[model samples]
Target: MVLTRSASRAAKCIFKWLPNEILHLVATELAPTDLAVLCRASRLLKNIASPLLYYSVELSTSSSLISFARSICQSVDASLPNSARLLEVAKFTDKKPPISPRIVKEINDALCRLIRLEVLILLQRSIDYTYLLEHGQFPQLVVFQYLVPSHALPALTSFLNRHKNITDLGFISPDSLKFSTPLSLPNLQSFMGSFAFLSTLDLTDVSLTHLTLLLYPPDIAVSHAVLVNLHEMKMLSTVEVMGMHANERAILHVIAGHLPHVQELVFHHFTSTSSPISPNESVNIAASLETLGELRSIDFGGVGGNVIEDRHMVAQWSAACKSLTSVILDERQWDFKENDWVVSWNL
Candidate 1:
């Protein structure tokens, strides 16, 4: 009982400054052995303890996330923070292949049960609920974590659909991670993830204001709808786009049309199979954006010389973008015959 009193005191002290009320728990109840008693040290240190106890009954085979998670469900703490369970579980576990169906279902059920939970990080995990028509909702989800999956797309989609109060969204799944559902995150402002099929993600139509799009050896034709609603949006602040192609030139044309209002633009891993744009090539990139006037900054990466005729096009774009405060280009474009690398802008 002495340990119980100590555990109670520890919980109170740990939460002494926190604005949230600390629900008192018995020391003996929170600790079944000396290791648990020793863990009653500090609040931050307690996260490790909480996930360990909340998810696992036997803390021995913790290297296996599955085993640890199985044990956590048996933890005795009634005050276990439900919102933190996902990350906490992630903290002390290792991933193994040939994913366990039962564990996946259990994690999904736990996530569903946390009606008030607003954050989740289910990396390299499978939480499938094929029969769950409950429409389990998370109206306040602010963050999500999904690594890569062979087929975890449905699990990710279900989580997103249930949450109407989301401000952030993310996913990582198998190649061509495409879904037919229209993503409507009214409050969402930031997102990052990989998609095998860019056609499925209509970001420009969505409310997202900040975005980072990346996937290995990118195929950019997937951005059809997002590229379509280019000029209508006034809230887009930052865009880091990759995998340039003939179609991407169209996307850039639309953005260039609105250049004066943009804060930042970055182009990465751009490779075009077609020959460089000519005077009559008909891809009027800078000409289309004459209305935008200027930009704050522009950065280009991995632009190969073989794909283009002259690097001076960068200078022309900078000249046209009257408000361009900063422009960056790669040093790889320098000629060996002339030590002169070049920039014409005043900035």
Candidate 2:
């Protein structure tokens, strides 16, 4: 299936006439290796692929990080703004001493040149990036995820306050910020962090509308505290509870009590149990759902129980909540059978 020289020339001629938009679309689907090769094909291909090639980069080694920083500094020297929009560093060892101050400075300098950077993810344990915030770098950043030490909280809070554009944030080790007063993020719309950290936050002034809590069968008192604090967020409309725990009923009641306006709910329970839902728990859950007048969707994952026997229970819930449009239990969807008013599960 080898092409002759004339045939190859004809193919190139046809491809050369393709629209730039089509070429950009095709380039986006190419693997990094393929993209590198494509960039060498012609000036137009190189121009189209350059931005995509450098758009999002992950560095896993100190040498690679240093090299990338040097390259970005070179781009700055040439008066060219970096094309990077997302940058991730995944290999910082938490137990080891921090990266050399010199390297950190160099990395900071490189990051400053990225005028369009919108997301930065530091998968390491703790790395101080206060310099970026202090210098007003990443002015367009809208999402940020990082793990930092307790001493970094002030700088982090300052950063959040300065960057009013940030709407989504994840603090992998939120314990660091627990002792500090809740930092107001008027524009923050979604938050992902530990249940303990989220429970203690004073979100009275924040505009949080979505919350994702990572839980591990939190202490009853802690869970109660979280729910009480969450009640203050009157605008919250979506909640996701994810963890391997057996307190589903308690969690659901808390959510229903605190976030009455929640329109979407997702439960990812990884705990395995053969026990069926207790009658009291079912009653409580139904009562809570009844209070969630705006509830529309519920997505359940890793849920196991007597689903067949509980069909009637689900039906009662559907009947009570006229606004409910869809209910997903594990991998099955429950639809109300109009003929008998029974809930039927479908794949």
Candidate 3:
């Protein structure tokens, strides 16, 4: 005779109870309604759900982000060095006043309590970044994505100084950046160079492996010069020029003379010199693209339909970048049609 335990008695068993780990996995996979029900199971369920939710919270608008941040620095439980992760931060932007100075210091103090914070991504939201060096002074930041206000140079420089282990640093979009003091991150790997004013800063000393400049076109000429200035730091991988006139002749010396080491490249505008830049130099077509020998790809940009004179230019690009396997061109012009250029890949 097989006897079965009573329902209440079986429910009381710890092993029989749905494990919080399993619930967590399910919570992530289940519908929001299902997840809410699990959270209501008990305090234990609530605690687990909080981390899964708040640990990587991506908030919405900058104003909303400010409210939570305000509450974080104000919470009676918000003591520095022992405070826990606050949940539900959004990824938005607003000109909310920088966190008050007093709150800034406390938030910094609170972050110090965290023995570890592996990855932190602060998008467009304005922050009390002044306190970052104090708390997010974390030892090992693998990916640090923060868009700093250009005026927050002190805060930015400070963080770079304190957090020496950041592998990927995204300065996002720093407007009117006057200068960059020396950054001492010995282990730094990649950097997103988007600030317009950064061209004046001397970044010659830092070891940068992969660098990108998504800044405006007028500045691209200056930025390209900066890349050429890198001399012989060979670990560089890709170069992208956005919405820029392709022929920035000033770069010929640096690109050809100095940076022969760059392998993959991208282009948007090819400036026509009206006269061949170099007598034998030919119009600066990839067909004539004698420089950047190791280039493998080019990310072409959108062109207005009014311009119909880019056939020879496109053919030159195809012929010049011999190693190019991928060419991403915009669809509006169909200049490729007249040029008899079929890239096999479309927009």
Candidate 4:
């Protein structure tokens, strides 16, 4: 209480002397709680503090999410004073007496008013809030991610078409392989989602630079459509793949074949049966790396049973790919230093 009062008094004392630009800068540095208190100090302060208070919001529980929704709904005409640009909800938990329809409507209404939102991440799988997306059109929204409902692909497709400004997107759900529509995002630059999801999109015209694929057993068999898209991405430079069911060597080969110009490669969470790659396999992998003339860094941090720290293996890769500068294996980093591989423990 004392600290809050002191902050309020300090803000009031400075408001009279400081310029509005200075006040805006100060408000940006204040925590959300302090910003809320500043809003109550005076009308001038409220105007300055309200925007920062709502600029970036992160809700982690049902109660807080409901309160935030209600607060926005109760604002002037349930619209003004909204300047939220980034909103990330951890999840909507399942407790007895679930969220009511009234609450949902309020959330939907409040979301519609946040026209300036740029990044929206709904990390909840329990509630399919995908419907709320249908009610709002965020003109500045560029990045959107949510747990998609298996039946909401049409709605998702429609949303993407309306928001052509979106460049980065991700949505994981059961039966994602059902998506067959030829979706297009001319502005898309980076995407992170299931491999099955990537195969369904028509992105041959898009110049993607970063790609992250979530793999499963079924995704091991790379589709022709996926290969076509990969081949078409002339600007792609970074790639990250995570899965346990696929062969690491085969995955590397495919990447080398289509993305010979890739600069950074990461193979995460792959549980390989071969622990320390056999001499023959190491030779073969190095031989494949030779094709990627632009490859600068390769990481296999969480690949189970894979020993990427072997100096001999690192040396082979460095020899095969002269551009290789950094290698990460099992939390250890090896950098090509002065004609030798230098080891750095990341763990």
Candidate 5:
């Protein structure tokens, strides 16, 4: 059924008169495209909805990046209060080529005007962001994710040192192994990066609560260093180990000693045959778990049946930790209810 022009106008008028809180609630549910269209209804609506529309800006092509940068630069009041809080710069594989130098310059210039930007995600590896980092463009950044090359590590380190307010950081720096110094991040609570980077961090002053480590094999020394660093972080409550290799029983022991306060643990073990863990190694893992008295939840994957089904392993793990609240094996989960483990295999 199509509405008459008068009826549409009446409905819009009614919507415009709704309470500000209700309107904001409604706006939160709208997609970015819908929110942009809604901003055209009235000046009041535009003022109320522009922030939501521009909260997260993703430029997937050089054209969009250059166009948006030009548009924002042309505006007399480029430093708008409702500037985008999150900005993502990346080239789509199926779309245009990588961002050109001119587009990169525009993006940096636009970032300077985004005074309230909180998160900056850079997936473009070729772009030089040293200028943006040196300039106080993203003064309010709390979360930063970047793909760093070896040459850019020094600049990235400098940026991280200056941004003490950053609470979450994710990096993919395969070439860079160590920083010049232990850059202090007093407010950092979550970190996601390679095991090499994690091992090099001096987190003595940082109170990290969540950590995600990307593991690699044949790096026993690096794994030991990572565990040593984890031992210093007494506030950690959650830990995730991805690409976990076999024969890391000693590493598991170190984890139990270091992350005593960790309540949740997830392990995505490597299934390659080259680093197969023995039954003895599984026993060591069970022994390590017994030491983690505060552990309430644990998830395991890709580890052999010897570790998962061993009677001593399960019995000791279940007996030593009275706080066992949830256990996830393979794709199934078990929750403790009435002092008995209840399976939820379907989930």
Candidate 6:
């Protein structure tokens, strides 16, 4: 599109009058499509917009992913000093052909240049492409979540050891449970995985503050050894358990007995569980609460749903656990108000 002489002059004037910082601020608000247009407008605009364009890349489609990988591999644009701080690559469909071995190599090669990356997430069922990420050298990466295969554990260990900046880590693969190597990351703060996986790691020196234990189907009980290891996490104050089975009471008992210093407790019970938490079970729950003097809040929003309707039981809990400031029973939120419990429904 050719602009008239007057339009071109006005555009030049606008660009000349705007400071680079102001132009950068405007560039940040532009969508990628708009940013691309801005980049083509002028050399100055291109320099201002190109970095923002690649700051965060989330590609879900096969074509887009391949195109992005190719661009990164071919990137000679010095304006983009480093690659994206956040990169999320997800394969949404199973029907599409698997990423070719050559493309996989290209992707891995491209990822190596993303040394400034702070967050990397891979959401795909197959480990074919993800296993290659073990070679990635994202030293600045802080959060990483990927499904790792058992065979790649050795390389993964080396990858993780090299990147000590990672604080929040999650493993979605069941094969991650087989990881029993001695791993250490002093700066690590949050971990999400199964109890078996947690037990396998020697995180005794790592001061983890948040723990999300996935127990869907409750395949393996939270063993005594796991609890013993969990108790050693002195900085651990928040605990979330998502699943249910016959050992619900035992789990609660373990939490109360082991992590007395816990401040917030959340239980998201699976809907697949046949038995709802009974009133008698609630009484047992209250009994467990009585021991948690430092507990500040307990959320059972997804535990028993509407089954826990007794306000009196909550009052009993509030009375027993003086530190309790908030209680979420399913959709209801009972907050400790000015000397009394005020009810608020979470609609």
Q: Rate the local accuracy (lDDT) of all candidates.
A: 0.49, 0.69, 0.52, 0.75, 0.70, 0.73
List the candidates' TM-scores in order.
0.59, 0.74, 0.67, 0.86, 0.79, 0.85
- lDDT tens digits by residue: candidate 3, 123-212: 544445556654355665566776666666776676667777677666655353534554556566676655353354345665656765
Which candidate wins on lDDT?
Answer: 4
Model 2: per-residue Cα lDDT over 1-347, one tens digit each: 11112234346575556667778888899887787787689766777776787788877776667777887787533533457888888864334456788778888777778878898877655445667656746778888877766666777777777777778887766342353656666678889877666754556667788888766544435776666766766688888876656565467877777678888898776666523556676677678788788888776643555566466666666666666766776456665445344334545
The residue-level lDDT of candidate 1 at 305 comes to: 35
User: Candidate 4 on 1-347: residue-level lDDT in tens?
Assistant: 00112244445576665667878888889999999899899977887888788889988788878878877878773334347899988765536357777776777677777888899888765545655667678889899887777766777777887888888887666543547687788888888888788876668578789888777667767643475567756689999886655354457877787778799999876453425456787688898899999999998774333344377788888899999999887567888877778776657
- Candidate 1's displacement at residue 319, Å, is 0.7
For model 1 the local lDDT of residue 161 reads 67
TM-score of 3: 0.67
Pairs that collide in candidate 2 are none
lDDT of 6: 0.73
Candidate 5 lDDT at 20 equals 68
Q: Once superposed on the true structure, which residue ranges of model 2 sit more than 4 Å away at CA?
A: 1-31, 40-44, 58-70, 74-81, 88-109, 126-136, 148-151, 174-179, 199-205, 216-235, 270-276, 337-347
Candidate 5 structure quality by residue, lDDT tens digits, 249-319: 35567678767888888876665442434557656766788878888988764444443453344455677
* Runs of candidate 6 exceeding 4 Å displacement: 1-13, 31-33, 78-81, 90-95, 127-131, 216-222, 244-250, 269-275, 303-308
For model 5, the superposed segments whose C-alpha errors exceed 4 Å read 1-25, 40-44, 58-67, 89-93, 244-250, 269-281, 302-316
Query: Which segments of candidate 4 are over 4 A away from where they belong?
Result: 1-12, 77-82, 92-97, 244-249, 270-281, 304-309
lDDT of 4 at 197: 80
Best by TM-score: 4
